[model samples]
Structures are given as structure tokens and as C-alpha cells.
Target chain A: MEQSTESDICTDPVIRDQWYPLRALAELPEGATHHTRLLGVPVSCGVTRGRPWARTESAPGDGGTGALPVIDTYGYLWTSLGEPPPGVFEIPEYTEPDRRSMNAGSFIVATSAPRAVENFLDMGHFPYVHTGYLGIEPHTEVNPYDVEIIDGEIWATRCEFFQPMAAATATGGQMSKYTYRVPSPFAVMLYKSSPVDPERRDVIALLLQPMGHEQVVAHNFLCLLDDVNSDAEIKRFQQIIFAQDKPILENQIPRRLPLDPRAETPIRADHTSIVYRRHLRELGVNYGVVPA
Target chain B: MIRLYDWELSVNCYKQRLLMALLEVPYEIVPVDFFPGWEHKSPEFGRINPLGHIPVLDDDGFIVRDANAILVYLATRYDPTRTWYPVADPELLALTAQWLMFSEGTTNTASAARLHDGLGYDFDVEACRAGAHRLFRVLDEHLWFGEREGRHWVCPSPHPTIADLAIFPDVALSEEGGISRVDYPAVRRWMDRVRHLPGFVGMPGISPPLATSPPSVG
Candidate 1:
């Protein structure tokens, strides 16, 4: 991947035009209007006639000034600041009849959205940060994973981890198989082995809305095939995992993720992260990225 | 009829607007130019509130000043459901009052920092930011354990009280003042729950909650 300077990434217009999920469609209350910031633009979103809509605000106090097209798919309300791409990314697992869809709710992080997405792709912090659940001291090794860019999307397959508690309903240790994908600059998806049914993998997606270059609102979506745990339990489990990650993301120096190879030393465990950053750089995402 | 001396961006004034919205009370806002004009400090406005605050409340000629005091008055008089204040419940009432005091600390620190940054108020920005973090840490830990016990709000009630509204604007808008809430996940989740309440509204910094679909059942 060609390395780009900080200026190139900030001026990249493509990132602004891509569809970003603002919130979960089911989570938005009826007749309720929500005010939020997307791509540094103040926006108001609400459902009208059973359809979700979003528009940018011209003034701070006034309501939405211009209408922006909205799409509801994969259980989220998606919008874009500029012209949106053709359609939202599709998750095949969402169609499974037995899988229960869950919204883990939204979290506002002080760090840039790209950094937050990078953190979601990182498994090396599982043992230390997530403690006994996702990882532990003795099982800290992140085995070699296969990373490839397919049709412009970054994918990491064959990733594996030893988890003491793989899921909220988990009671014992297990080896979890994983596959990570970055379908968009600010969005990431992880498919991992389900504790209830190892044959059926659980799909978790982190849909991020960049409020500014240094701020983001992360919306987590979980598609799980579990009969033992309630929907609330699943949402809580994801919240706990992300909550453990929030502090580390916030404290990183420079706030934005560095794209230059010399910015920060990467160990072998960061292979996926390295590839993800390179892909972001290649896509000219510089809004929240810094140079070495 | 209730009249609120209001400013659009003032977090203190937002406290009253939020509570009144949650209670579904009707009120008219007497707009006070708190920004470039500094209308609240003007002699004419001082006649309404000698303290020169923009959130003074007048209910049919009865006057109330200060954000928390107005919350108590509004809830006590307007919330016929009695859940917002819960004066009948002694333990919950005390807890509510305690958090109301806690909200004052947040206002002095978090909201104060916002004043310095957004309105160019002269204050020790770093000191205010640090103070806000200290308070947020305490509240985050408190709310984290509260979730474990199934206590969603500050006062241990299933329904949110005035205390949540009191502290929400400052905490929600802390980012504008350079205070990061990334460490306080429990507080962040509580903000979502409060936003999900019926009749909830958003100001400049506060965002409304998404529509929640009922949990999928077997």
C-alpha cells in the first residue's frame, strides 16, 4: 500500500460520502427527533411515517435545514454527509432464522472513529484488557491470521483465540475461531465461535458515526444464535467488552491513529491492525489520521 | 402558566427545559441573550433575577431561581405521576436530593469548562476539566454497580428523577469543554437510558436516544 501524507487523508472526499449508521432503527422511539453530529455536521434524525430520515442543520439551534437520504438496513438507520454510496453493506448472517439480532447501544469516544474501528479489530488486548473473559496471561499469543483485500474491503480470516468466557452465557474456557472484516472506514465486523453452538458463529459489527475528526459514536450490532441468554444479556456482554476498551482508546497520544509506518512499532500480533491501517491509508482516509 | 428565563445554549437553562419536557408541562420561554449581548446581566433582566442567571422560573407570578430548585418546584407541582420527584418515598427522595447536590459540582466544573471554551469565559480551563473528571469517575463507578443491581437511575428508581436531568447536560456536553467521557461507560449508557424516556428532548450537545424495538422472543 502507498503511504499518504496527513493532508491527503483529511482532504479525501470519498470517506464523507460513504453511508454511516447513525442509530438502530428499532432503537429510535416513535415521533422522537434526535440531534447528533455526523462528519462534523450537526444533524437531526427521526422516523416519519415508519421510515427513518436524517437532515443537516444550517444553524446550531434550528432543526434540520436540508434533507439527507436515509436507509434502514441490518437493523440500523444509515445516512451520509455527502452523497451516499449505492447501498449499505449487507450481513448474510442477519437473514438466519434462528439468529437473534441485538443492538448493544451507542458509545461516544473522544478518540477518532478510525482509531475506534482499529481497536475493535485488535485481539491482542483481549487477555489484558478483557481479563479472564476474552484472554488471559498464559493465552496471550495471537496466532498468524490471513489478511487480504477483496474488492476493496479488508478481511482477516483464520484468526483464533483462547477465551475463559467467550460469551455472557459462557461458563468455561474454549478456543474461539474468528474472522474480522472492515467493510467501511469506520465500520468493522467480527464473526466468532458461539459458546452455545460452536457450529454457529456469532456476528458482531461496530458501526461508527464520526462526529468530528477526533470524536465518534460507536453503535454495536450483534447477531447471535443463542437460546440460553436473553437479548439484554447479549447487549450487556458487548457493552462490557467495549467499555473495557474505551479507556485505552481515549488515552492514546495524538488521538488520531498514525498511518506512517514509523509512527508506532507494531508487533507480529498487530498484523491485522497493520493491514487495516494500510488499507485506510490507501483509501485516502486522513480526517483522523496523523503522519509520523 | 410557567415562564422560563432562557438561553438556547446555556446548560443550566437546558436543565429546566429537559425536566419540563419529560414531565410534559407547557411553558413559555422568555429568551435572554446570554452570549454576545449578555442580556442576563443587564439591569432590566437583573430585576427578574438579581443573581443575573438566565434560568429563573416564574409560575403564575411565583418565582424560583437556580436550576435544581426549579426542578424540585416543577416536579413537585407539575408531575402528577409523582415519579419524577417521588417525595412520598423517603429513601429515594433523599438519594435524589443528594444527586442534585452532586449536579452542582458538575455544573461548576464540566459546565464551567464549557463556558470558558465556547463562550470565552475567563476561568482555569485545566482545573475545571480535572475537577469534572474526578466527579465523573465517582459517578461512573456508582452507576456501574447500579447496573449490576438493576438500578438504572441515580436515585435507584426504575424511572428517572430530576437528578438525572440535573447532571445530564454538563456530562453530555463535557466534550465541548475538552473533558472526555470515554472512561465512563456506565455514565454513557445511563445517558442513553435517560434519553429514551418519553418526552425526552435534545439541546446543542445532548442527543436523543434511538427507537428501541422490543427484545426478540423465542
Candidate 2:
């Protein structure tokens, strides 16, 4: 099926065993439960003693046995459906003393989680989809970037692009270097040259929560070492850039990602996408993907 | 000489520019950085208009503040056909005024939702989207009946009035605010009509019909 009409939960152990970020801690107040869905299963999250907790919708509210494993790390409240992960993945930059870390809101995209993650990894769209911000026309050519799987995580290094207005603190056009990492199937992070300090790079992560087989909530988190640009300015930059991708994501032909070989034509620029699909296939992630 | 305090992305500001363009009125833009900069809200801009909003027009120091009001002034002063404002016909004038009021509802909801999404304005986006849909439903039914009765514009007239220009930007750019116009067939057709209007102009998000003409060819 091109698009799942009803809730299609991926019951694969590979998927359920992995943790998904349900919501950011900023979304929940101290004593209120925010009802949400995870991989088409109803889930609720509430904060307790400054620590967030999540429970499946069918579980008892008084903290009976049904409370799913919750981990408060990387600026979000992460939970799992089946066997819990040993620990959340590492992001040493998140703990940097001078970094300004914040939860940059969640966006509801009407597409599969993989499709959202792939869009995060795609840079060819920057010159068009994010015109005047990330990149612009005539400077649309994607230079050679290196992509490979390192330590079970896919990395695309040496990626660079020209951005007229790269970030909220951008002064002028600068050739920004980018390093993309796919730590989990549903998460992608990019380390780009800081607008002020080119020697240092900024971190922006897109954590996908598959509400259904064809619906995903993209939680944006930013950990940056910036002496300028207030919280509102940084958040606004992220919101505008992500909002521009919403129409393009929902209007995709397949709605879900196609992983079968030869399903899509890719160029040298799409090396990251090609490797990402192969990585997902090897992991047997059939939830929001079409593998024919 | 006419001067417009314009923001390139503001739909309300586009309403004025579109009307002036259609009326063949020459105007220069005094650009205001509405987003990121908030130049419109600055003390320097407040002296121009105490309201601290954009799309303000000055015709040799005779100022017009609101987008709809500027549309009325432009059409009444420039267009010789008198069909845009129809000041002579009380019934048509009243009808045009009614739809202009309808444009206010769309501007507040549809365009406001776009602001919340793009510029980080704090608004209840769900309510903004729902309110826009309800107004669009009313507009679609009206336009559908109008099309059946051989009327194309929002008012019952042979040609478009300021009402069409006033509401065009909000409905055209509704998707930017996550308000889909797929269900409103008549509204889409009417928007197509407005896009093909003589001397029609478009701002950032609102573009004219494709496969019909070429100017800003990439």
C-alpha cells in the first residue's frame, strides 16, 4: 500500500527494541500528563520529581507495572516498546559546558519516519526548499561528500554548501561545512560550521517519532556553542526552516520511503541517501519503508 | 507619487501592491523588515503610523493605514471603469464592502497561522487553521453559486473588485499556514481567475498561474 489508511504499527523486535523520543521535556509541565502516540501505540508522559516518566496508554496511572522504560537524556523523554536499550546513544557535545542546549519544538509531518529522516539527510534540497536561508540557486551544485558506515552508524563527512543566510546570527554568505550522522534509524544529526566561530561546529538533531506507519513527529533539538543569538532567535530559525519542508514532505509521491534497489535514481549528491537506505535494509527496518 | 511601507512576505502588504499593480498605479516601496528585524514595530516606524503594522500607503502625504482601505482608495482614484469600487451603485458597493469584511476574517486566521508557523508568532495554530477552513467553506459555497450564475468575482459583478485582491493573498498562501485548499474547488478556480487579472502582481509566496505566461523564468 502506498499510504496506510489506518494505524499500522511496526511490530518488529528490531523497531520495538529501539528507543524513540516521545516528546521533549519542555513539552510537559511539572505535574501534567501529555497524551501522545508512539509507533501507532497510545502513550502518555508526565514529569515526576523533575524526572519525566512515560507509560503506555493501557497502563495504570498510579505507576503499576505497565510503565514503559523511560530515559531522560539528550533533551527529550525517550521510551521503548519492547526490550529496553542498554543506554541512550552518545552525544558528547550535548554535555559541553558552554553549549546552549534547548528543545526546539516538535513538528508534525504527514509522512513516514524514514522519509522525514531522509529529508534531514538530503542537502540537494537546501538550495531550493530552503532558498535564501540554507542556500540559493546558481550555487545549487553539491560538491563531492564522503559517506560511510562507522561503528554501526552512518556518517557523511566533508559536506559543504554556500548559504546566504545560514543561521540567525549569519552576517553574510559563507561556505559552511556539514557533517551528517545517522545514529538510529529514526534520528539524524548535522554538525555545521558555526556562524560566528567557523573553527567550531553547531549541532542540530532531528529525532523522529513515528505516530503511525505514515505519520511522524520530528523533534528538533539544538546544542550549540554560541555566545550570541538568544533562545527565541535560534528557535525561530529552526521553525522557519523546518516549516518550509512540511509541504515538500507531505507532497512526496510515495508518502513512505522506498528502500528497494533501483526504486529511485540517485546521483553523486545522493550518496548519503543511498547508504542510509542500505543501512536501514541491513537492520531489517520495515516499519515505514517499502522494500520490494 | 505613492509610497507603500511594504514587507516582501506580508500577505496584507501584498494586497496593496497587487491592487496598485492591477490599477496601473505607480508606487515605490519603502521596505520594512517585518520578520526577524521587526522594523515595523520600532519607534522609528511608529512615528509613521501609531498602529505599528505594515502595508501603510502615502499618496503625497495623504496616508492610508489598512490594506482594505488602501484598496478602496486606489480603485476609486485610479480605475476609470468604476467596477472595482462601484461607488455609484449602492447595492454593488454594499456587496463589495461585505466581502472586504470577509477578507478581515481570512487575514486574522489564515495569514495569522502563517505568521505563527514561519515567523514564530505565538498563536493557537489549531484554532487558526480551523477558523480559516470555516471561512473558506463559506467563500467556496458563495463562489460556486457565483460561478453558476455567471459571476466570477466575490461580488455579483462582471469584473473583480478590491475584495478579490484583498482575499487573494490569504487564500493563495493558506498552505504555508498548513491550511489545505483541496476541498474548496470554487475558491481555487476563483484564485486562478484573480491570478490572470490584467497587470496582476505576486509577492514572495503567491505566484501567478504556470503554463499560461512567463516572466520570472528560472
Candidate 3:
């Protein structure tokens, strides 16, 4: 399987445009309640509950005069279900870049977390935010250097070491296990190759969704685990994994934080951190001493 | 048989139960306990509703999740008389839909928050109170000056429709959260008319469901 840079969204024009308006509007008071032209069409901002109007100065031309738009959320229900007006919003059409191909082993992706993606790219303040976790590491230590471009996909290498010593007296058997941490905090992907296909490996994509400001929804998408299955089984598994993450993340206070990559030291164990930070730097985001 | 996943104490849930009772439809009640998490976040229950919210009615096999959906579904499916819900009139349906949205979008959340906060259940009182007042002012301004002779709220002609059935309970119970329901005389009177309907069943403040639970079908 090919490894790809996770922070690709920063360079993606579609993501930047869609995210900017929402981020801007969410900050505005009653912003959720206002009728605004999103991409040049009047779309009801029902989520924020008119916070934008409350915060900003509404001039005479604006609807916030003595006559505020009916401000009825009921009307929004119809708008949400109906088709978008023609030419109302510009839909950016971007295709995935072509990648160079190579004869490789079968790759199985494991459970991955989205929060990890959010944390990795966020290089402004991680040391303080996730003090005990992957925070406050020196820039050089967390750098990704073994960059290789294969079929338009990026792959990097780092030496991973593990201590091994375990024996069961009852069965007189020895147990050996190796754990691999992904550059993303969202998951720890361990590659397992079957005996027949020694070069083939599987990956896990663990997802972590911060459900609310203080809550999180985490799940592991075990790709290439089994062949296509029944929808019922798939739905059940998804619900179970999603449900497990709901309570754990919900109870966490201050669920998210900005990542800062300075004022901290990195040990040999910081191999994954290096690759992750390099990926963030490539996207022109903040990387500690480097300001963007 | 129609089965309602409802909490008797909930005015929102009560709307469906009242509709079922008034329509005289035989159904079963599956009580949901908000305390020990009987229905809210259970995985088994989550399959029934991905959002993990309540007042789900299973009419035979067809399911209606939200209270407003349940009200509309029951009225359309069972009430042939159309006395409770007139299906033919678009204006009436639209008006009813409008108020139902008001009740759910405005009144329900605010009033319930007041109840939860006032009754010592964990809820934000200041936020909830402000929300309650915001909605109350709208309802009051409309009720205080709007045209009304001696009929219930938006029943159209001299009687209560499904709209009234939808709005009446929450408006009446708004006071339980320390809200001055008496401020809006029109709303208060409308509340009385709704309560006095034949076969009317009050929430009775949290009761245990019987072995043979009553169905909450319209």
C-alpha cells in the first residue's frame, strides 16, 4: 500500500474556501441565525442562532434594522431539504492527482483518528496543549526526511525499535509483539503480513471526531480486514466502535487544542513526530519557530 | 399495534399519548427513563435512531421519530374524521405545521430547560431562561394582540386541531419552569380548552408503565 501525506487539506483550495466562511461565521454572533449569501446565494444560517447580528454593527442596508428577517427556524427546514438554486454556490471540482505505480505488497489500512490529523498539522501550540502526549518536542527531532515519491504518493522511513522479552511458564511458550505508532495521533497502525504473502501488509484508519467542543467520537475503520459484507454487520460494527468513542470523548474537558512544536525536547521515540511535523511544514502551516 | 417510546412526564412525549388517547386508538406505551439512561444513548436504541433522541413511535412497522413527526403521522394514518387534523386544506396544514415548528423550535427547548433547571435537574438556568423568555415574548405578542374570539390557539374555527394538540401541553407546562404562563391569557385559556377535552390524559408527573402498556397512536 502507498503512504500519503495526511495534511493534504491545507493545500486543497476547496477545503480552504468552504472552511473559511464557516469558521468566520461561527465566530460571529447570531451568525448562525442570519440570512447570508453563501457563495453568492441566500442560505439560512440556522445553526449559530443569530449570534452574528448580536455581535457586529448592522448598518441600515443590512436586514438587522428594526425589521430583522422573520428569524424563523421553521422556514429553514424547507430550505435544507430543497435543491440548491442554480448557480447559487460555486462547487469546486478537483480531481485526485495521478500517482506513480509500483509492484508492491497488499496494504491493509488500520483504524485512524481525525483528531490526530487536526493535531499533527496544528504546529502553533501543541507542547502546552497535549503536554503529556505528543507535545512540546524540538523541531529537528520530529522532522520527516526519508521522503520518497513513488507513483505520486509520498513515503518516508524511520527506524522503530521495540524491547522484546516475554515467556509463559505454564505453556513454556514465548510471546513477542511489536507496536507501531502512526505519524497521526488518531491511530497506531501495525502492519501484519501473512506467511504466503510476505510483502503484503494491512493498515488501520482510526477516526476520532470531536463530537462537540468537549466531546469526542472515535472509531477504527479496519480497511482490507475482510471482503465486502452485509450492510447490517457493517452498520452494527460501526455503531459499536462509534458508541465506544462517544462517552470517552464526551467526558473530556477542553477536548481540542492548538499544537506548538517548540520549547520542548524530543527523544529517539519521537520518530513518528518528526514525519508528522515535516508533513505540516510542507503544507506551509505553523511549525514552531517558523511562522506562517 | 402502535407503540410509543415516550416518557409520561415529558410534555413533548405527552403530546403523542394525548393524541392517541383522543383518537381512541389502541396502542402500547414503551416508557423511556431519562434518569438511568434507559433509552437515550443505548446502542440497541441508537440503531432505531442514529441521533439518539426520543419520542419514537412504531406504528406496526412504520416508525415516526420526532414528536411533531409522530403527531403528523398519526393524524394522517388513523384520524379519518379529520376533525383533529384536516388533510384537505393546505392553508390549515401549513398553519398547523408553522405552529408545530414554533412549539418544537422555540417553546419546547426553552420551557424544558426551565423545568430541568428549576426542578434541580442539571441544566443551564440562565441560558435556558433567556431562551424561554425570547420565545415567550413572541408567543405573548402574537397572543396578546392577534385576532382571537373565544377559540383555542390557531384551531382555525371554534375547535382544537392537531396544532393545538401539539402546542397546548408545553405552553401549559411552561409555568412548571417558573415561567409566568398567566401572562399570556389567550394561551392560558387555550390550555384549559385542550385539557378539558374528553378522554384527556394529563402527564400525571412520572408514572410507571403498566404490564400492558397503552399505545400512543393518534
Candidate 4:
């Protein structure tokens, strides 16, 4: 006999509060065809087998988008593969062109604006959260020089030579000077400041959207001087950067309570954060601060 | 061979199924029984997932678990060149991820709570109500701010992405779960764009799957 417990799958300490077994709610005897309504949506209890397939629906032309709505079908069997379930569709392996790769002097990383800005400014987090990844010197500074809002999107300027950043700039080194535009507060854009002579320049762009508060969808884009360029190296580089950001960013709790201001200590290192926080406060945006 | 562990009426499961249909991927379906505690805890079933959850996908030899992860894998590995996975800026990707998280983590929770409580399930009605209120309020605020900026809730792009696909089902079905979506006109408009997608799928009326008679294990 096989038994499934809520504890086995739902590892999240918080989610466990509502982790009742589907079987408990279904009211059917053990070893029967099981089904339960989770959050009001109907689903078979559990078990999976056979190849994947969709439930049959009428052809779209038969009526319209309103008719013949789509649905999924599940059947359970067995398998020897130790592979995990498919979370998203897969992309076929392909050989990318070199000129389009990182050799083209462009790279892209996709992450949320909050996480991105925090990473750029919070030197203390890098050493701990992104260990063996980025280092910061004791005297590192993240000075904000300018802030602008064009058509509802925000662009800010900061001078940073925290660590490897200095080395990257010394060699014809441009700091991470880029324009960040949030078309909607939910999405953010970061691209190199250099222009392509009244048209374009080497650019790396990332788009982040929320799947849910805890989960997010991110994609990487490598924009180049020429639209026809191709490169596998840049793609690999972009993916590596994404992999690096994933662990740290995902670990951040979006809704954590704010620290106590009265008992708090402020220092010179927090000058940049204070300025940014005050600006947002002036705009009446609640950056997770509690009232005194 | 493609094997899918899915429930017939789930919007999240439909998300994956819809993609397969749009991409014309061939797959075999496996039905799991959730009612009588049969499939979920069977020794045979436990082998696939000890958690005993549905919406599991089994590829030729590889298995992908989470619904969003499966969607990302499909768009990337199967339809990389398709407009579905745009070759835009990294911001677009971040923007999409943000919405996906909102749908699955926030909207889904509220929507589900409304359904369970409204439909007479053993739900914590007060808790559900409070949760829904908080979640919808954030969305309402975002929309209010968006309107001030001459935009709706769409991300930073001129077009839509998987972000929209990720959120549409829950937002549309929210009304069925006892939510008064009329208050959020912007969300309604945002849903209109989602409905117009090339291969959009809508949630169906709530009803249990077929009731099969018992079979003897002896």
C-alpha cells in the first residue's frame, strides 16, 4: 500500500498550515478513483503515467474563442525515469553564432527591479548571498547622482566601482552605466548607456514579471549593434548570470516586515539607501515601512 | 514518449495543455483520482511522486514538475523561435516573471479561497475574505497607479508575454470564486487582452469528473 502525506510534498513551513490531503476531503473509501476540489478547482487526487495529452475540444472555427474551451486530462501509470515534472516547455539545443555571443561586447541578465537595485547598492549582501560570486571592499560607495521619471518610467544614476567593477572599467572600463525603465512597475529594463549612433548600441535587456508573489517569470535578451548578429557564447553568459541571481533573489521575502526605526542605527554606508527610501517616501509609495 | 499527470479542470494544468495544443506536441494523458484516496496514495502512484500531486509531466525520459517551470521549458526548448517567447530585453523577462509570480502566488491564493468558501467547502471564510481583500487591494492600487501613467497592468512592453498567460485564468475565474471583479475595471481590461491571445483557454464550470464504481483489489 502506498500513502501520500501532505508533509512529503509541501515543504514550505508557511504553506503547511493548509496542507490537508485531497483524500481527506473527497469522502471516498481508500483505493477508489479519487478526486477533490482544491481552492474550488476540480482535479484527480494524484498519480501520473503514460504520455501527456490534452482533453479533446471542438475545433476553434466550430464556434469562436468563447466556445470549445480548453481543459487538461490526467492518467496514472508508472515510469523508471527519475526525471522531475515539466515546469515549462523546452528549447531545442542549437549552435549559436560567435558574433552574436558575449564576444560582441554585450550581455543580459533578467531579475526583478527590487532585487536588481538592491544588488547594485547593498555591498554587504553580495559576499553572503552571492558567495564566491562578488566581493566588496570596506570603502565601497554607491552614490546616487540623478533620478528621473520619463513617461512613468524611472531612470537613476549611480557611480559604483565596488570591486571587479573597477577592473572591468580600467580596461576601457565603462561602469555598469545603463538605463533602467519600468514600463509598468511590474517589469524593469536595464541596457548599456552607449548608443548606436542615433539608432542603437550594444544592449543587454531583461524582462521580469510575477507569476505569483513567491514565483516570477524572467527572460534574457541580448541586443546587439546589428540585428542580424548571432552568438551562443552570449546566451551562455546570460544564462550563467541568471543562474547566479536566482538563488539570492528567490530567497528574498517580498513582504517582510520593516525594521524598527526608533531603535535603529543609521550610518554613512546607508546614505544611498536612505536617499532612495526618502525619494520613494516623498512619492507616497509604501516601501514596506511601518508607521511610528 | 510524453506522459502527463493532470486534473481535467485545473486552469494551471490547462496552461500547459494549451501550450502543447498550440505547439502541436503529441502526448498521452493519465488521469488521477482525487476523490476516494485511490490514486494519490497507491504504492504504484507514489513511485511517480511521493507528494502525489497532479500536473506532472513525463517527457521521453525527463520529468518536469512545476506548472510554470514546464511552461518556461516548453516555450524555450520547443518554441524558442516562436513569438510566444520573444527575443526582447531582459526587462521583458523580468516583467513577465513578476506577473507569473503574482498569478500563481497571490491571485491564485485569493481566487482559490473565494471558491472554497463560497462553494460551501470546509473553508475559513473570514480568512479567505481577508486574504482576497488584501490581494485585490494591491492589484487595485497597481492599476490605479498604472492609469495615472497612461497604461494598464501590462508589463513594460508594447506586446504581451507569458506573464499575461500566467495570470489570465485566475483573474478571469476570480468571479466564480466569489470575487466581485467589477470593482477592478483595469483588471477586466487586462483580462480582455488575455482572452484575445492566439490560443487562449478559459476555465470551465465546476463539476467533478465521472464517478466510477469500485474495483476489487483482490
Candidate 1 vs 2: which has more DockQ: 2
Task: Compute the interface RMSD for each candidate structure.
Answer: 15.6, 8.4, 20.2, 21.6
Alpha-carbon deviation at A249 in model 3, angstroms:
38
Q: What lDDT does the true structure give each of the candidates? A: 0.81, 0.83, 0.43, 0.43
For each candidate, the DockQ is 0.03, 0.12, 0.02, 0.02
| TM-score attained by model 4 | 0.38
Q: Encode model 2's per-residue lDDT on A7-85: one tens digit a residue.
A: 4756678888888898777656699887767776777888987878888765222233468899988878999988967
Per-residue error (Å), model 4, residue B163: 2.2
How would you encode candidate 3's per-residue C-alpha lDDT over A179-251 as one tens digit per residue? 2334222323333221122243333333332112222223233322223333223323333223223323322
lDDT (10s digit) by residue, model 3, range B1-218 = 99887654556777888888888988986655432223467787888777777789997888879878888888888888876677788887777788788877545556566445322345565566567677766776665454444434564655467877776666665544545555666565445556666777655321223325442211
Best by lDDT: 2
Write the residue-wise lDDT of candidate 1 on A194-250 in tens digits: 888878899999998877787777888889877877554566567667756766777
Which candidate should be chosen as best, given DockQ against the real structure? 2
Model 4 achieves a DockQ score of 0.02
From the highest TM-score down, the ranking of the candidates is 2, 1, 3, 4
- Candidate 4 residue-wise lDDT, B1-218, digit = tens: 67777654456666777677666777776655432223556677778878765568888878877777777777777775544555456766776677677777544466565445322244565565566666667776776676667654456555555666666666655544555677776666566655554554433331111234221110
Flag regions of model 2 displaced more than 4 Å. A1-7, A59-65, B1-93, B100-138, B141-170, B173-186, B192-218
TM-score of 3: 0.39
In terms of docking quality, how is candidate 3 classified?
incorrect
